[model samples]
Target chain A: MNSTDQNAPLLEVRNLSKHFGAVRALNDFSMAVRPGEVVALAGDNGAGKTTLIKAISGVFQPTGGEILLGGQPVAFATPQEAREKGIETIYQDLALADNLSIGANIFLGREPMRKAFGFLPVLDRKAMAEAARETMKRLDFHVSRMNAPVSNFSGGQRQAVAIGRAVYWDAQILIMDEPTAALGVPEQRKVISLIHQLKAQGRGVIFISHNLQDIFAVSDRIVVLRRGVQAGERKISETNHDEVVKLMVGG
Target chain B: MTSTSPAQPAEKHVAPQADHGDPATSLIGRIAEGRAWLFLAGLIICFEIWSRVAFGATFVLNPFNLQSIAIFAVAPLLLATGQTFVIISGGIDLSLGFIMGLAAVIAAHATNMAGAAIPLPLAMLAGILAAVIVAGVPGVINGLLISRLRVPPFIGTLGMFGVARGVAFLLAGGTTVPVRNSWFALLGNGRFYGVPYLVLIAAVFVIVMHYLLSQTRFGQHNYAIGANVQAARRAGIDIRGHILRLYVLSAMCAGLGGALYAARFTAGAAQAGEPLLLDSVAAVVIGGASLFGGSGTILGTVAGALVIAVIQYGLVFVNVEPFWQFIAVGVVIIISVLIDQAQRRFSGGRQDE
Candidate 1:
């Protein structure tokens, strides 16, 4: 459905492998995401979906293989490096400080500072508040108190705040790990709509979910993993839930 | 994908007021945040009434009584300032008390040696500098143990507490080390513009600390770390480095408190801050900082310290037994914690809705 599907891959993995001692958590896994496209990563428990995402997001180094971004081979030593290169990962646990305001959550590590009295540096609070307002507005999410701590928000709103953080930083590729797993039915739909919004903005999204229905709804293509390797890859239009489930379990 | 419009909805403007429909909760929230000041005001009023009824004298209006109370607050307030940062970071520095004692003993010896070779003002400065720097030794070790070795903060700091206490007593040669420097005594006892010089110094230090904890990036990161360390790590914050620096800063505060203690008493005692540790922690908690971390203010701690000082001084001023002061402070701490728990439940309930 993405008009820019013909565009060069925003993030590409070639024969990526990650091993932990005697265990081959992910082996020779490969995937590609293009601009304005949504790629669903679906697999059963312990199927190596987490390993593949973690490796791509720079949480762990691959035992073998290469990652290419924008057609150039690259490697990230840390998650911060990945983020700096426009690869943002939203974990299922949600990396948000519950006691902090949405704006504070948005700029946790990378706080913007303004000079006070033309010399001493201080937090630019006005800028943070304004950014929170604009970012949430851009996400089509509305909350009464922009300054309220994210803890007071519902699961869907908290998910939006995390996405808004990625959006505010202008991440080109988003890897969401089970983002809709814990949300209510309505909240899951809201998250799916948010993914659509991300696609409309020409950003690449790699959505990981257990729900085959959610994957079918938002993703253009699904990449299924089984036992640390690529199980099958299929276009949404060319496949159905039965076939995807078969790929997840293997034969 | 369909083109998703990014325009704001008309109803978006109405969201703020709609969520605030419960004005009573908002009012309670505001009061909770400022409860430290409220408690202090209430304490003062009670004391004022008691003084009028029982002693036929003024409690708050007397300049001497006010000065004595401010002096009483000084050491505890300084120790509490450091404790405030540590507590906000979701850690405790149990060694702060002995660290202050170690610095006090070191300051006395350093000042005596420096006085023999240097001018009076320079000697005083040298002593204070030496004490603060030396006090950072245990702090560095504390940081290393807790951050690098992955030891629990409580256990690590408790170990350091013993280490510092033993070292302080050893350095003091099992007795108080007397300082012969007149300048040190002047700094401790002298008054400027109707205020003690020590009080002025403390006021300035507290103001600077308030800025550090409220206006700076370090302060914000501190809150983030305390609120959720996993989130902070995910955000790319340098946790180990920050923890190391944080301990050093905390120790330096205790060091300054120790140096001031030596100046005030004109001697360095191994037990200089032994009794103040409890007071410092109590001040931070009474100020509304959650022991679990992520919530506290330096100003609130200021009010908390004043509350304790007033309780101690007011009780003595009213001819009440000094032992009752402990009971009164304990009661206030319980009351403050109860208020914190109630506020937490109130806000926590809204998350589900």
Candidate 2:
């Protein structure tokens, strides 16, 4: 491994731990995510990938250890607070309102409002639609229309919308959990391309996936978590899929 | 080489994939897509035919009869509007009838205590406040249990149903409380420009609700939470607060409806809105709102209420037995539910295929 110490990472975790009753979901795990980088998190089922993500995303507060963002010690009591601090997570389910239009889903909670005559406020649907179109275009996503309900969109298109939502909200650190899971080959390709696009935009991405091909394709580095602890970190150039799998199994 | 470009073959496949050939034109297709509106239209037509032909024809388009329909429909309209939010969020509030009853009793009692010297508006306000408070309690409980404790909404609201009804009976001493305020009657019985105040209030509430549900951030969150709660949570939505407010708003509306009912009748009877519970659920179902959550409209619920009211008036106009009106409502509810199920199944099949 090339040991190069550069500028501080965007996110750093030290001895982060969590216990669900008698079950130890995460234990003394540590990692760093630098800006403009994609770090793939791989582990076997029940290896605490979700727990670690939940801890970082503020879904489940860690029972111990500290999390620092931009080298400043911070704690998030709620996911909303975490989001405000630019830590956004996209779960495997995508967490989108399928009945809403793509534009609506993209701006679900924090919608832009237009002030007409200084008092009467209205939703800026046109502006939102335009932004959605632009964002999707930037990602090379060819959705036919922004007005269509998200339920009608294919899986790849929906993921694009989800990612667009997080990115549009100015999320500096993006944590995507199994984004390509349950998708077809073409859909997986679309998501991989989008991830690369996000990296190109200078955002730090923590990608969780079991597919090694996907990990090797988009990740700048791989962080394997074996049974709630960081097994090791491997640079994309220095490590092959087999070595990463071995580390994932704590070899 | 030019003829064998890879983009040409990909483009060919794209055209066929995009043109899945208009599923909207097929028999099951139209039903799956447009059944909600179709059911609403069909109900109106049935009521129109029955009110005009079966009845002695004197009631058709008559102002007095129209006013009666409005008065009869207002309670259900208010109840269904509240139910619309609850159902769209994939929950049910069966305690609405009891909550309404409690509100009626409280309003009547408060209005009477305010004495003859008090102005009618203040008395009305008192009643509204009382009902809002009583209704809000069950809502808070429902919200806490459903959101915080993770209790099933049905079980939570059902328990509230018993508690609220018992409170109503207890407060009223199991008897009717007569409202003596003359001005309070004006709200229920008075008319402005030929429109009954009762109908006008119902109209305003429906319009406000329609805008809130269709155009606001709150409405978006409601649908998101209803369609999938975990997804909503992951999206950083405050699910607990939203559900709490949803149930509170629903109960508050029911409370307001109860106050309106008390004004219309000049008496608060414990049993006044008992039948409304079933009718409200029926109206919501008939209006094409999904009980499973994530789909509904105020317009649909309004139409559903009108359909029910028209049926009731038609039965009275035709001099049919009172019990027959009950049977008719039951049949309507059953038919509406079946249509809803069929539409859901048809849509599900299409999505799977």
Candidate 3:
């Protein structure tokens, strides 16, 4: 059950489970995210945080679960299917095409196309560059060279580009897997701020992170998992870091 | 949620503007992008000067030599042009030469019966259709194996090489198939407005391929698929289908080259494509396309084929032994691949973007 407002949750995972051979990666998991909410996912290694995220984003299919979007049940056969359902996953690796221009990557699979002669449509590069610049501006993210390859971008900037790609496509649920790991203190902070910006725009977020400070900084609520099961769920205001830390570790 | 600002984004850390899109990537930027263009130009200049000094006049690009060069350059240029598509997609077609040879044999037999039994124009169409079917069908098979069956591109294409060659030999009965159609001869050898039709055809193909590689979504997908297959797939790019189509296009390009060869030579033989495989690959690499994949242009390839022409003309002009041409091409391939390796190292092998 959800809170008493009666509006449908933006994303709801009910009785979700994933099994890899004999390993139970996720067991009878359930969580809900409402509009404009940031739900932090916290756990140690092998705790099923990543597995659940992958299940939600269509990287891995949940062996048993009902993923309901706005009260309508959905099944994602591929990652593209999830994206079509307005769910975007920013994987740990960033998945940016390093060789393509920032604008190109921003509009990778879905480039602005115009028919040249007839029937054979080509990329309208001018349109792509303009749209990319526009979307980045909306995110308050700036890059001097929009036409340059992403391989030239710094680690953080590349992450920003990856996030921008989801935002540009109007993804309703942004699922970030380890959004802040391997980043500097400042780069990490930038990502945290970007998450706030995403929430401000009324998009729901499922943020998975090992950093307690980062999780505490942005989440409206925290869901803790341990050993492939839901350990606990707590409202940020109702619980402290020590309680969440204990839930993540074990008894 | 917390209202505090996130740390400053890392958007301002522009390093030394040594990247491809920088102004430093000017005409020198363009030339610096490919080893073949840089070395080929220097080679031509050196060959021209040496020819002028040694011979009474500049025999390097005289009309007689130029015509011969154009004729010889046609078949290989077509093959290299097609190879550009495959290589940029991080794939290769080792069977290209044999595919062309097979197309030529089919076209020869088809055209031989055209004037007497079929109409001349219809015969030409039949000849072209035969070439396309023979070459394109196998190419599709190669694509299926590589994409659907998970066969390595090198092995699949190499297997195609042997198969196509064997079929060509069987089709020709270990001999040349004579072509007698005068129209075929004209297209092969004749010219309008003082340009060899063969050269003209190659130039037109260059423009078409350049457009295909640079101006279309298909071209971008090729780069994307080659640059990073996983990223491409996650982007929802149909990698398997795209790769299948790419192999077909590659084989068909060789088919077109074979059709043209049969037209020009007035005969088709299994061994016709023996030298072409090495020559076309050399020309492609020399044109600035990487064998390691994800970067190449048809313009560069055409220029590369021209480089071979210049070398052949220059060597003959300098009275170099016939065997020296083979040695010279071998040396060129080695040097070009070396330069490509150095480029890969310096660019960190990640500039396909």
Candidate 4:
């Protein structure tokens, strides 16, 4: 059976809880995503899957919990902080600026800067274009023009651009929320393979999805969340689709 | 590493027809596609022809009339540039006109204070500074209300429209404040080697703001925020702060425009900038900047402002009643909007992929 290594998990959440007034969105939920692992986060609607992922990615701060990154306790007051710490999240809609150029979108907030006036800083377009080109070439990502708007790219190309952005920053832990939900069958398959490629690179990935088939095809470990709590954790080799389905639906 | 390239995903079987390699063909395509250039060129040509045939060419740019055209054009151009930022950022300021009026009043007061103790130059600086701050603070309030209090920009700025105008009147007691300094008069009427100082100042702002919109990270973020605010926030942009600054810029520009107008007339009346709000908006809208926001160019807006001036001046040059100028501008705004809607439908369909 597949088992988690004794080594520290890349990200460990201890009794994480988030309460929206009386909603109690997430209650004492805890999970771990480890290096070189594809941890499938399977949960039905309102199962706190979104809350959990958002908290981890710093979109929402858990009301009660301690999060350790690489065994070092960290607090992310903003997504930028989490990103600066080498953790990236691909939001459900890709969160890309549709009208901006690919290079501009990839390097949106953390643009490379040059000194324009003694100490004042301005965007270093040359350096940014060069970096974007080099990164795309290395990652084998095909964007027709670095200057073209992201809106022109297809659904699959947009996803790849999102992935390229995550990889460009050399994020250690990748959190993808329903990556293939809006994509077609062929695009879905492409994303699954991309997940495998990230795994081969020894990076940890937390894959959130509603599709049980996708969860089984790629995950090394499965973490099913139910009503804001961790209902079960399994080794994919030791679990079956029916059992995971029951766990997800709270049987 | 898995022999799977993320760039050429399996579903992406088609690539867009590549850009034409020929520079001349590509340039022609871009100009045609841009639409704004064509509309502007057409307006200029039509006006040139109308003036040449109906009236003597001198009516268009005679020695005395050139100054008037330069004078009337500068105010709308500055206000429209600021409004371009407002619209592209997905907001509108109904208070800009009144904000200008208030700034003019304050500037007039400061100019009158110039000869005593304060040197004339220092007094002008104080006047400009006073006007800018008075005008800019309402922008801050507008931003804070919209960002922190969750007030809609339209309502917030609408409230500011009344507040700024009321306060301007309260300060002035509903009267014009006149200045005694000829130096301030020189600012309004002074010529630097035959070029109006006002046009020179407005031109500088045009170049600077153009660079700001087209070349900076801040400019990119402005476009992004208006494009998809949620996406912008997710990308870790400080949306509230950036928007606040844009409003400040908008107000500062309006204030500058008003103060200059007051200097030219040597008096600050509470209603001095009454035409500012509508005129600036018309220029921005006619410039092809989307009222729905997220897209605009400074040069296009400048052209739009010039179109308004051309129509107004051209009507007078051709001996048409001056009131027809308003009707013409109203017609242009409608046509501009029609063009914008049509272009959005047209260009958005180009990527058949």
Leading candidate by TM-score: 1
Going through the candidates in order, their DockQ values are 0.45, 0.23, 0.36, 0.33
Task: Return the interface RMSD of the candidates, in order shown, one decimal each.
Answer: 5.5, 8.4, 6.5, 5.6
Task: Tell me the docking grade of candidate 1.
Answer: acceptable
Instruction: Point out the worst 10-residue segment of candidate 3 chain A by lDDT.
Output: A1-10
Sorted by TM-score (best first), the order is: 1, 3, 4, 2
Error of 3 at A182 (Å): 3.6
lDDT of each: 0.90, 0.80, 0.82, 0.80
lDDT (10s digit) by residue, model 4, range A26-132: 98877877766789998889998889878887877889988988887888898888988878999878988888876887888777778777765667877767777
What does candidate 4's lDDT look like per residue over B302-347, in tens digits?
8788878877877887788999999999998898788777655655
Between candidates 1 and 2, which one is better according to TM-score? 1
Better of 2 and 3 by lDDT: 3
Clashing pairs in 1: none
What tier of docking accuracy does candidate 4 attain? acceptable
lDDT of 2 by residue, A145-231 (tens): 567567766777788889998888888899999999978877787788788777767678999999999898888789888888888
Residues forming the 10-long window of minimal summed lDDT in candidate 4 chain B: B2-11
* Clash counts for the predictions, in order: 0, 0, 3, 1
Instruction: Count residue pairs with overlapping backbones in model 1.
Output: 0
Clashing pairs in 4: A142-B7
Residue B198, candidate 1: C-alpha displacement in angstroms: 0.9
Model 3: residue B71 alpha-carbon error in angstroms: 2.4
What lDDT tens digits, residue by residue, belong to model 2 across residues B77-139? 898888999999999988888889988888899888875557778877777678778778888
